[model samples]
Target: SGKVRAIVDDKGQQLKEAGPSMPVEVLGLGGVPSAGDNLTVVENEQRAREVAKYRQELATEKRTALAPTNFDTMFNTLSSNVIEFPVVVKADVQGSVEAIVNALHNLSNDDIKVRVLNGGVGAITESDVLLAGGSKAPIIGFNVRPNAKARELLKRDNVRMMYYDVIYHLTDAIAKEMIGELGPERIEHVVGRAQVKEVFKSGKRDKAAGLLVEEGVIRKGLFARLTRADVIVSATKIASLRRFKDDVDEVRAGLECGVVLEDTNDIKPGDQLEVFSVEERERTL
Candidate 1:
């Protein structure tokens, strides 16, 4: 689909032909071929068309082999809770297109994934706009603007379009979009850890653990978990913290204290206790 319009040498001089291993920039490629793709010259336009068609067939076959369309995949996708953010990408050259696609894929996480419908080189065309509209995907143009027909289609379809000359800006914007789709994330921070040194009866029916503060400060009312043999046994909170006979708010590391767990009385000697806090923070890609 592309004709070789010109070849420019490194010095910015136009050349009729380039020799093997002689560096040059080729122009007029219909689409940017992937890196390391061979560029062969054909004798005539008809022969060029034949080779292009053959390559297209091979590429399609490879794609099908990698991911085949099937009912199981469809059902799994329909049943899954993962959010997919489909997008179309267009860049000025082959290298830029590859870079952008890789960067976008790396942004995928447990919450959402960036699904690129199509990525190509050159000005965004009407076909690209149509695909984006059908998929409800936004079009990302890097150093390239849409053609007149594409612009009209984009407006008519009410499709979103984003243009960027810098890769950082493009990724940053896409990351923000992903965060918007997934909302904030909850994160847990371990504030203190302790080990049960002994177990004793509390009041008449309750039990408390004598613990030696090991890492951080164990504070009353903090969420905690009890572990035995490296396995989590119970998720509970510190109902009460006592140093000797006096009630205390917290017991710091290297100290011994009595801790009564809320709703949990199965703690035994040598068990591990971890106290933590939870917070909601903005997610990032």
Candidate 2:
């Protein structure tokens, strides 16, 4: 009799009493053998390619699933006007500090101010808590724990300390605070009205206007207005100005700058033009 060998199928099931000379045929029992399986060279390589493809797809899916749902979630949550509550981040790890900073910087609005109370290597100590005390900013520690004294001080001062080993959670917390503190926001300051004294056309879509700085200063990148008897009639800006065509910074109370008011629908020699500057302010929380 020939030698007997034990064979395992693709599912790792044992096939007993198989002899080498017994006309044995080994096929993929379940699906296919892995590329690294010590079977046939061709099957091994084929399985390897399939395995590699599967691994790549799985990795891609995992990354996609983990990606942030809203790019502006942090910004929308953190950008608020309420300055009463400040958020302080204290990190002993350079990487952690940077990650937090980057997330804050990338957030949507710059209104929510973030102060880094203390950042360095080592555990959170009394000094860090003291720095954050007056600001009323919540302290964030990364991969660091407070000592007994620090803990006691935190309790005495009623300071809030948040610890995190994961960066996403920290960012999420900040965003949540922002939203909770600041309510829904809307853009309000738009369209300021300034009176125009004189208008001169220089080129296409360009005009130089000599005007009294009326209700608001004529700022660049804002709409211009020309009004008659408190009613807006002509709205425009001095596209180009001169002591004879020299560019200036701004047209203030008595000075003037080159303005380029594109549209000329409601403009008159005696009408006052009001330029509205639109600005957004945080009002909730």
Which stretches in model 2 have alpha-carbon errors above 4 Å?
1-85, 186-285
Estimate TM-scores for all models.
0.52, 0.37
> Candidate 2 lDDT, tens digit per residue, 229-260?
88855555545334436666456565544455
Candidate 2, residue 142: Cα displacement in angstroms equals: 1.2
**Highest-TM-score candidate:** 1
Please give the TM-score that candidate 2 achieves against the real structure.
Answer: 0.37
Candidate 1 lDDT tens digits, 1-285: 578999999999999999989999999877767778889898877888889889865753453242527989878767778898889899998889889999999999977988888788899988788878988999999999999999999999999999999998999999999999998887899999999999999999889999999999999999999999999999999999999899999989999999899998998999999999989899877
Residue 108 deviation, candidate 1, in Å?
Answer: 8.7
> lDDT for every model?
0.90, 0.59
Q: What number of clashing residue pairs does each candidate have, in the order they appear? A: 0, 27
Cα lDDT of candidate 1 equals 0.90
